[model samples]
Target: MRENRLWSFLYKLQDKQQKWLWLRSCYFGLKTTGPLLLLGILLQGLTLSFFQPHGFFYVIYRLDRQVWVPQANFIIHSLSCIVFGMTLLLLCTAVAWYRARLFSKKETIPSMVIALFLLFLFNFHTKRMPSARLGQVILNGNIPFIEVLFLGLVSAYFYHGLNKFLHFKSLWSIAGATVSLGIVLRGFKHLFNVGFFASLSGPLFAEISSLLGDDQTQLGTIIVREVGRNLLVWLGFVSPEQILVAHTDSDLSRANLSAALIKNNLEGLPHPLNIYSLSDSFAVLGGYGQIMALLLLFILFSRYRKRRRNAWQNFLPVFLNLNSSFLVGVPVFFNVILLIPFLIVPTVSILLAAGAIKLNLIPPAVYQVPLNTPTILNAFMGTNGNWDALLFTLIVLLVSMLLYYPFFKVTETTLYRIQKGTE
Candidate 1:
């Protein structure tokens, strides 16, 4: 029974992998889809400009007029509905191509382009007519639904036909198709003012604010969600939250500190003081500094290994955090137990900083700082000239380095053992 269950699980996993691959292929095929979609958006923009008197100028105009602009609202709403419907049609077509086995078998760029143009024309004409008149002028019944359905069918047929014609047998061709589809969708979005993307912004910001609450939590959430999630996903980890804390207590403490500071200085504080600017310091450190450091380290290590080719036999694996690869491929993990210390060092330093702030040994961060500021600058700005943050960050860095030393030693030992075994 256990054996049967194991087989079933493996089969399910295999099925999911296959589906993911197919979707990825469609995402890649966009050299043609990109231009066509852009053209569609441009045309829509032109149409809006021509029909509306205020035109593109009104979009950015902030001045409020006392008079009602009925024509402007009518034009915007009608155009938005049509553009939205057309975008949906294109997206559905891409999804169909992604799922279709035939997508791997053909090249139908010409047909796909032609079909897209026709659909655009149909949508434009339909949108020009009054909404109430749609039912009266239908080929079958309900003109709007019929037009959408017909366009969808045509798009699917073209996609399938293109797959057969192009003979997209390779992985690259599938990738091209997916990219093309994405470009087309983006173009359509540009044409419509209806706010498909805008709709997402409010909800996304709300959710982010809810999760992060304050500046520090927001910063941590951004790192974990944006950076950690991307890294873990690349490493084949399914759930990012399992590896990183989605929310840190440090954020709440920081917010509380801000409130206390505001209360203490209520009478004398600058009226227009900006607290969020301090965040830029940590942003620059984590974003640019960390990336540059990692890249430089990798490049230096790679160059050094090139001089002694055998060095790569162990160095490459540990450098990638794939110690198991060095251990099994080169057999280094167990022998390189020192590497364990290096791994713990950075985490420990961060935890200590967090602990000190929590215990009030160090000040809780109060200002809302920008993410682009250098570490020392962030501390200075957040504390309004205080040097404690600068010192704290430097201490953390030193601790991290100390932690890494033991790990490097373990790595060296593993490399030596692997080399000896090979000899």
Candidate 2:
């Protein structure tokens, strides 16, 4: 009877695995378009980087001498013109088809037509006029209220069309599409002179021109600034000032002096980071640590499969870095008896380290660094040449691992008990 029950459970688990595999396969096939779209976007980015023209009137005054020959500008402008022309043709075709009632199936084409017409009306009103007097009229905020209504209509139509194309069925998809459309329209308004389908100048366009200063490097500077800021923010770390204040309670006088020294050093240095070589330290540390973690996880799984041991299943959550998955699956969720240490150990370890650093038991970490370059390497690089930061990160990792051990054992015990009960 026990053997039969064991066989039944194994069969059910296999069935569940098969179901998951099928669903994953279907999702992969459906998202195949994602890769092609990403490739196209990458190509566009590379073309803009190497070839695009710099400055205002790049499109209007293609004959003018530029520092870089504005070849990219011409290409982008020509492509935009082609896109605009094709969109116009497609809308006209759709309208004609609708009038003839030739195809009743796809409502998407008509929806696209409405979107294009609305965008056209917006462009018509906002476009800059050739005459100086008419340009001043637009500058003086004489835009009609009807034009504002058309802009709203344009936004709504764009949202609809994007939703149809992307097949956005969920609320998250709708919100994301709406935000993306807003950003794209804003880019168009700033980059190109056409306003509301009309040839007109607006305050936004004027601001862009003034800020960019007719320099060839304007676009490059913009790209660098935006990308650099975003990359820093994506990591958990903030600016040096923010990190110092949050992690230290040193006297204002001493803290300010230390920060100033670090800042000056960073400004004086020309290299990416003045400390240890970034490529050597980060590549080895992060690469090795991640690989070790994966290898350990694989070993645990292999052992479990061979031994048919329930304790092996307890490692799943930790392998995924969730920790709570095994606990909840084995129903350790409600048991406060084991939960306290499980949560407190890791939390306490991190907090203790932070507190010690604040109290100067160890030197405060100085660098604003990315975590991808092994934690230690990131810290060392951030500190402008301090090897001590690397050592500190190593200590912290050790403490964190020690804190996690008790929780791991508790989870394993729970899984074993459940397995025994099933038997």
Candidate 3:
């Protein structure tokens, strides 16, 4: 009788837990409804403003000239965008609040008043003229674009949803979100777009980074750009000819390709960006952020026997610098503990090297490098047989090692614990 009663008690407890989990998931899902719809509208505006997808997230070539709707001025567009945004907020928030029981009558009235005030402000601003700031924001990226912010925020919320979904043991919604992200999200007939992660990863430290200007070499800029860059690639944002132009013209990748014809002369017409060696400075040991160092460390020192063993076996492939094994083994993407450091290390390393070049402490790399050349060698070759560039990469490599160490250590322990069920 006692054993039977015990089983009965446990069953009731499990049922209660299941209910609680689903209830919480529903609440969170409802809360996200407004933001998700707002994000969709913002995405539409960005696509309209900058680049258009050729049916279902196809090749995203640069626009020769931005297209505006027929007979629409910036003011008209801005007003329409604002009006549509308000409609979304009203529709989404009302449904969400009703479902989630998120607001009291007392709070709802004030919230409605605040929403009305925004409507008035947007209308007032419409008459005042849409400032050139809108265009400026897109060009120089001086301010956070809603497109980028939306991606980062949605990724975070997706993770939040995943946690709740897992707690509730809801296979249905989990499959739905994942499948939808890849296929139905953009309505692309293809099964997946590589840019799916854009809305699912990156930009957790946005506020911290924003305080630092969105400079090319700033951590704040790198995190958003790192994720945004991949998304752009997945969206096929750059054409081969455009990439060629950018490589030859961009201060980052441009080398004196004519160095051989010019008798290795690296002098150039005066330009602020043209002065520094960028291609190799940005390329660390194996990949961006010099993650290979961490992989090496893991192979060498990981206490988890199985992980270290796998790393040891894969050393040569990783050394040859194949990207696949280490990416999954270290599991760099979406690993929250490592994300901040992954974003910061490359920027810090580049800034350090850029400063050295600026101060004439090192020779600027001016040669075009082979794309697959190893980083340390690229450092040596790209700088016209200079050893200092190699040394600079080594120094930056060491610094990256330091930055990544503690995070890797913590992650290793957490993974081990999870594997062993010790926690």
Strongest candidate by TM-score = 3
Residue-level lDDT for 122 in candidate 1: 44
User: What would the TM-scores of all predictions be?
Assistant: 0.32, 0.28, 0.44
lDDT string for model 3 (253-313, tens) is 3424554335554444132133124433443456444666777778777888866775665
**Tens digit of per-residue lDDT, candidate 2, span 125-213:** 33355653332111111222122223433443454555556666665765566556646765676555435533365676566554533
Model 2, residue 406: distance off in Å is: 1.8
The lDDT, on a scale of 0 to 1, for candidate 2 is 0.35
The positional error of residue 280 in candidate 3, measured at the CA in angstroms, is: 4.3
RMSD of 3: 17.4
Q: Which one is best on lDDT?
A: 3
How close to the true structure is residue 382 of candidate 2, measured as C-alpha lDDT? 50
**Candidate 3, residue 309: how far the Cα is off, in Å:** 2.7
Distance from true location, Cα of 96 in model 3, Å:
29
Better of 1 and 3 by lDDT: 3
